[model samples]
Each structure stands twice: as structure tokens, then as C-alpha cells.
Target: MQTFVTEAVDWPDTAPALRERVRALVAEHGERDQVRRANSWTKPDPQFSRKLGKAGLLGMTWPKEYGGHERSQLERYVAIEELLAAGAPVGAHWIADRQSGPLLLRLGNEELKRRWVPAIARGEAFACIGLSEPGSGSDLASVRTAARRDGDGWVLDGQKVWTTGAHVSHFMIALVRTEAGSERQKGLSQLVVPMDTPGVTVKPIVDLTGAHEFNEVFFDQVRLPGSALLGTEGEGWKQATAELSLERSGPERYLSSMVLFLELVRHASVHRNPELDMLVGRLAAEAWTLRLMSASVAAKLARGEDPALEATMVKDLGNSYEQAIPQLVQAAVDFGSPDNEVLRAVCFYLLQVSPSFSLRGGTREIVKGIIARGLGLR
Candidate 1:
């Protein structure tokens, strides 16, 4: 049976410097509202994203020829964690910088690279992953969206639902069936569909907070060049799973409720109680543990290793930790008091959104099943 491998991660020596730079940038331009900062990573501010691009913080690990800074993976990790901790508005470029750009650099054709990579690195372009569908949530293999060859090009016809950042994205890297009559995981392919394509449509799905972060995207006979295909056709399952390892393990997974945690700390400082004290301690410890686990996965990625199981594990635990913070704080603190207004506001916001923490990367059931299979329990 396999087990999670934990080891001391040797983060880069440049980490401290990178953290300082990110903190300074965020202080000057980050979101200021406590409620807005609760899940800051999902807060879109195109101007702030542009500022990060100008600061050489985006695309830190890719080739300089592709407009990247050519920095180490851990350095990139440091920058992102600092951004999340400070409640920086990074959602505009989050998907692009986090996974899409890296996937494109790894798998895209020359034309695809030339057309999107540099723009993405500059934060002028944003991307969204087209994975979930109407009947398919985390079951990627159940995707029915299809692409067919048409005289040296491809025609895409399908719809993707619950796509985060779709409305703000310039393009989408979608998983679709390439070969006719393919089933499950076979014959799947990733296609780069420009959001501005003639037949593409994006409709916003507003959440309970009246936020338009999720979207439904429709591709009605969208046409693309052969070069739009990402990675090997019929091997999209493998490529996409690899991309998901990048998605599942990151600071963003655990830091979504960090602003609330900070508010909890502030409330504890003024209103000292044993219950609040214990809650804060427990949350802090879990946050630290999740940070270590996440950093370990990042280190493995830097070394060209696929720690899919470990990444899945980190995401599961991190999601649970983040999702619990608001609930715990609401129970421990007195929201009826006027002094706890900031804390009350942040907690309520997170309570509404924390349900999505486990759903986004992969649902709790799906993530746990992956873990069980990895351990030979399934």
C-alpha cells in the first residue's frame, strides 16, 4: 500500500526576498476591504493583475523566451503564498498563471505558444479550464463535449458549466472527445478555444454573494486550427490529470479563508476567552501543517516528480481546514457585539463561500476516493 511521503522541503534561498517584494506590491495595490479580502484569490482586479505582471511575479518558472522570469518553482511558490496571505486580488490572472500557462508551455504547439504564452506571461491574457459539464462535476472522463476534424481544422460543439473565471478569461483549455464514438477516458483531447471565437458564448452564474465568478460557456460549432490541440490527442486524460496535480496542490487551496482567520485573531486579541484562544491555536497549527505539506508537493514538482496522491491529500485536508475556519469562528466569537463587525462580516462571507472550497479542485467524495485508491483501499 502507498503512503504519503513527507520530507523537509529545501525552499530556495531567494524566498525571503520574494516574500518581501510580494508583500510590498500587495500593500500598495491589494484589496483593502476585510470582507472582500476573505477569499481574495477569487477577487478579480485586472489592474492588480497587471501590476503583478509588471513586477515579474507572473510566469516565474517558464522560459524567458516565452516572456517568463525563469525563476525557480519554490520562488514562485513564495510569491504566491505571500500574495494569498496578504489578501491580494489575484483572481484575474490566477488560473492563467497557476496552471494554464504551464500546461501550454509544456504541451502547446508552436502557433499556440506564440499566440498565447507571451500575452499570458504579461498578464494581458487570462484563461479558464473547461472541465465540468451539466451532468459531469468531478467525473472528467464523463465529458461529452466533442471536437471533430473538418478539412485540416476542428469544429467544437458542447457546453461547459461551473467554469471559474470563464467570463474574465481570454481563452479556455477544454477537455473534449476527439475521436468519434470514444468512451470514458479514451480519445479525449484538450483544445485551446479563444473566448472571442465567433461561435463561443459565456453566460455568468452569479453565486449567493452576488458574485459572477462562475460561468457557463457554450461552443456552438466553434472552429479552430489544428494547432489549437493541446498535448497528444487520445492522451488528454493523462495530460489533464497532470495539470490537475498543479491545480490541486497550491497555497490558494488553503488560503481562501485566511482573511477570516486573521480577523479571528484580531477579535481574540480584544476579547480574550479560552474558547477563542483554543480555536485560534488549532486553526493556526492546521494552517502551518497544510503549508508544509503543500510546500513538499511543490518541491516534488520542481524536481519533475508526479506526486498526484500527495497533492490530492493536501487539497482534501486544506479544504477541510479552510472550510471549518468560518464555522468555528462563528461559534467561538460573539457576532452580536458591534466591535466584532469586521470579524462578523468576514465570517458570514466565508460561511457562504466555504462550501465551494471542497467543490472547486475536486469534490470531497472524489478527492477521498482518489486517496483511497492510491492506498489500495478501493
Candidate 2:
């Protein structure tokens, strides 16, 4: 069996300062409602996002020419860690800053880069990924979305489902079949489709919580210039997998239920019980360990290493840890008591949404399969 390796992360010297900066910004303008703060990364606050952009907190690791701060990767990591820990409303620019902007910087043509990267850095533009379809679920290889080449551009036609922030996004980086009769993952390409295109439409998908976070987007003969192609044609699967590595290992993966955890801590402090104390200790230890593992993966990425397997492991473990917190808290606390109202509210909210912890980024089954393949157990 291949063992999962753990290493000490040498955090950047600027981390403390960055953390302080992020904390102060979040304190001043972050979401105040406790329930809303539970999964704050999915909460859209465009004004708050623009504030982050103005603070130079958005696009921290890209080049200056593209309106990025050109900071170290770990420095960006520190900022995001602070934001997620504090339950800041960062959803508006989160996708763009996290993976879409990075993907563009890595492989986008000059026109695409110059057009989108700067707006992204300015928080004037936001992006959503078009990876899931109605029947495709996590099987991205089964995507039926297609784009056909025209005289000097392409014509897009298809629908994307479960697209987070699609209604608020300026564009979508979609994986579509570019070659006729392409099979599975072959002949796929990533296209930059502006959300405001003439033939594009977005319909909201309200969850049980009555939140409009996901959307169904349709492209009906949407026309795009040749420059809309993000990277090399027929290489989208490779490019997309690389992007998933970025998505799966971030602080957001584990910090979704942090507000509930904090509420539990608050309740325990006043209502003091051995069971609650033990639970707090266990959850804290797991949080610390996951943080270490996540930072280690970030460190490896900083060193120019591909830690896809390790990142996948982090996502899987972190999802489980996050999804368990609410259930554990519910079991340990007396939610019927009036004094526990705050804790009960946060816990119930998380319980309703925590199931999605393993579904987003990738499903638990898919993540485990990837880990199994990496360990040669499949």
C-alpha cells in the first residue's frame, strides 16, 4: 500500500500580516448572520468581493501586468485561510480567483488573458465553471455540450446544470466537444463563453434552504470568437483535472461548517459538559490535522510539484470531517433548550446543507476512486 505522506509546511513570513489584514477586512465588512456565515464561501456579496479586489486580496498570485499582486502562493493561501475561517462572504469572486483565473494565466491565449484576467483581478468580472450537466452528474466525460467551428469563430449549443453562481457570473469556462462524434474525454475543448451572449440563458435552482446558489444555464447558438478558446483544443480534460486539483484542496473544502463549530464551542463554554468538551477536543484535533495536510499540499504546489493525489485525499477527508460536524454537534447538544437557540439554528442549517459537502468539487465516490487508483488499489 502507498502511504499518504505528511510534511511540515514552511509558511511565508508575510502570513501573519496577511492574516491580520484579512481578519480586519472581514471584521469590518463580513457577513453578520450566523446561519449565513456557516457556508459563507457560497454566499455572494459582490460589494464585499469588490472590496477584496481593491484591497489587493483578489488574484494575489498572478502577474502585475494582469492586475494581480504577484504575491507568493502561500501568501494567497494565508489570505484565503483567514477569510474562510472567519466566514467571510467570498463567493462572488471565489471561483474566478481560485481556479479560473489561475487556469487562464497558465494556458489562456494573449487575447483571452488580457481581456478577462484584469477584470477578474479588479473584481469587476466573475466566472462559473460549466462541468456538470442534467444527466452527467460527476461524469464529466459524458458531457453533451458541444461547440462547432464557424468561419472565424464557433457556435455553442447545450445546457449546463448545477453551475454555482451562474446567474451572477460574467462568463463560464465550459468543457465542450469541439470535434464531431468525439467519444468520452477525447476531442474536448474549454471555451470562454460570456454569460451575456445573445443566445445564453440562466435559470435559478433553489435548494431546500431557499438559496439561489446554483443555476441551469443554456447556450443556444451562442457565437464566440476564435479567441474564446481557453487553451489547446482537445486538451480540456487534462486542463480541467488540473483545475480540480486547485478546487479540491482549498480551505473552503473543510471550513464550510466552521461557524457551526464555533457556535458549538460557544455553547460548550457556557454549558460546560464532559461530552461537549471531548467532542470539541476531537473536532479541533481533526481541524488542525486537516489544516496541516492542506498546507502541506499547498507547499508542494508552491515547489512546482503536482500533488493531485494528495489533494484528492485532502478533499475526501475534509469533506467527511466537515459533513460530520453538524451531526456530531446535534447529537451532543440539547437543541430543544431555549438557551441553545443559536447553536441549534447553526446546527440545523448545516445539517440541511452538509450533505452537499461531499457532492461539490466531486462526489465522495469519485474522489475515493481517484485515491484508490493513485494507491494502485483499483
Candidate 3:
């Protein structure tokens, strides 16, 4: 029997101060040319990322030893909350700060940590996940990327797709099959791969948003040192699963369309119709509830608890909200000549890309299955 409770945790009193600092940072960047973005966090902007890193907002939860601020986890969440709300261009440091750097801290060896963690904390370097493959989507255990040992090093051969920010990332925390003749989860291993390595090719994929954010990467006879392994060989499945938990539960999952949502709310305040008011209120309530659930999960992550089930649940609900925003707004707003051009444009952009919302973190079906397993209904 299992019982899951997302008890409301009182946010630290210092959150107000932290929120103000991040708000100021977001406002500063929002005014710059080539930076006023609608969905800022998903788009990579090295300049903005460096600024955020300089502000000590990149690795708030990491230790000072790793070039971090050694701040509390809730503080990290508060900072991230503000980033996503403002649609700050955090894509460059998003993966590294969210899971890659934390993964290294938990499982990477001393050299690996020393080699990458500091730069990541500084936002000078960027990282991306290499779990999804051409044939494998959410079925991470089915990854076919092979990292065969070759004397003191290893050789890699395979392909990964739908890898966000791969083209701009310096490194990839790739999960591969390390054991010959092994199937499924048994032989998986997490490896630190340099994008400049020979035989590695990156092909950009244009999403519906007409952006080159997602990528398809190929590893043909790639060679790597044995030290590239993040943790014990054949334990990658365990490590990768843990990392997915972090990915599934984050502010991004819910805030993907928040910029548009807020836009609509502002529009409503200025020019309200009864129908638009009702729609905005309903969406606001949904977003608020999802925020509470997400915050609870963040607290659990801080306590070092594996909340995969809880995270899956949050991702599903949050993703639905994100996916629903554009459609709802489209139906509610008069698109002929919107009263707010900025708001209407953001709403249009979100509407075009929101269909992929449920597909990004994990498909809705996959999350429901995980939730079912958590309740012993599988």
C-alpha cells in the first residue's frame, strides 16, 4: 500500500526578497533588443543566460564548492518561478541547472563534477539530455545508443531526436546501452559527451514555431574516455529515471503558456467581456492549483525524496493547462483586430505550438500510466 500526500509547505519568508530580485532581472532583459520574447525560457539566448548566471540565479541549490550560491531549494524554485513567469530566455542554462548539474552532483565522479559543474553554475556552459532516440520516445529503456568499451575508453553509435537545445549545448548527458547482449533497462549508462567529438553530427529540427530549437543528433563511431561515464556502468537506468523525475516536475511544464495567459488577464482588466472574464477566471484557478501541486513537489525534491508519481501527476495536469490556454484564448478573444497586439501575438504563437505541449516532457498517456502504477493500479 502507498499513500501520496502533497501537503502545503510554507514557503520561506525570504521568498519575497528573492522574487523581487528575479523580477528586476527579468524586467531588465525584457527591455533589451532581440530579447523581448513570448516564451522566453524555451528559446536559447546565451547572452541572457550569462546575465542570469552572473546574477547568481543559475544554480541556487548547488553548494558553494561548485561555484554556486549555496542557497536553499525553495529559493531556487522561487527564482525559477519568476523566470518562467517572465518568460526569461533560460533555455541555455535550463537543462544544466534543472537536472544536468544536479545529476553530476549526485552521481558524477570528482573529475566530472570539477570539469563541468563550475561552468554550468556560471552559465558559461550548456547541457542537454540524450534520452530520446529516433525510435524511442518516452520509452527511455529502449534506447539503442551503444557505448562499447574500447580499452581505456569507449565507442558510441546511435541517434537521438527531439533533443531541445542540442545544437547550442556544449555537452549532453546521454543515456546509452553499455552492456552487450543486454536488453531494456539492464545495461544502460549515463555518459558525459562533448558535442565537438568526432563522428558526432547535429541536425536541427524546425518545430511548428518555426524555430530551430529541437535537434536530431547522430553518433557514428564516436570515441570517448572511460571517465565519461557519469556513474557506475549498468546503473544508468536508475540514474536516468531519477533525472526524468526532475524534468517532469518543474515550473516550465505549467508555465509554457503563462505569458499568453497573463496577457489575456491583462487584456481582460482593460477590455472585459463576460465570456472572456469567465474563461480567464477558470484558467487562473487551474494555474493556481497546478502551482501549489508543483511547489509541493519542489519541496519534496529539496528533501531528496523520489516523487516520480507525484511529478508525473503535476506534469500531466500542468501540461493540459498549457495546451488549453491558446485554444481557450483563441475562442474567447476577437482575433480580427485585438485590443492588445502584444497579447494577441503571444496568444497566437502559443496556440501554434501548444499542441506539442503534451508531447514535450512526457505524453499525457505515459504520465497517466505512471500515476496508475503509483496507486498500484497498473
Model number with the top TM-score: 2
Model 2, range 1-378, lDDT digits (tens) per residue? 445677878899988888889999999999899998988889889999999999999999999999999999999999998999998999999999999999999999999899899999988899999999987888889988999999999999999999999999999999999998989999999999989999999999999988899999999999999999989999988898888988889989889998889999999999998999999999999999999989989988988988999999999999999999999998899877899888899899999999999999999999999988898885
lDDT of 1 by residue, 1-378 (tens): 337788899988998888889888888888889888878888888889888999999999989999999999999999999999998889999999999999999999888888898888888999999999997887779999999999999999999999999988999999999999999999999999999999999999999989899999999999999888999999998898878899899999899999899888888888888888989899999999999999999999999999999999999999999999999888888778888888898899899989999999789999999999888895
Better of 2 and 3 by lDDT: 2
Candidate 3 at residue 319, lDDT?
Answer: 87
Q: Provide the TM-score for each candidate, comma-separated.
A: 0.98, 0.99, 0.96
User: For residue 119, what is the lDDT in candidate 1?
Assistant: 88
Residue 251 in model 1: lDDT: 90
lDDT of each: 0.91, 0.92, 0.86
lDDT of 2: 0.92
lDDT of 1 at 72: 92
Better of 1 and 2 by lDDT: 2
lDDT of 3 at 273: 86
Order of the predicted models by TM-score, top scorer first: 2, 1, 3
Model 3 TM-score, all chains together: 0.96
Model 1 TM-score, 2 decimals? 0.98
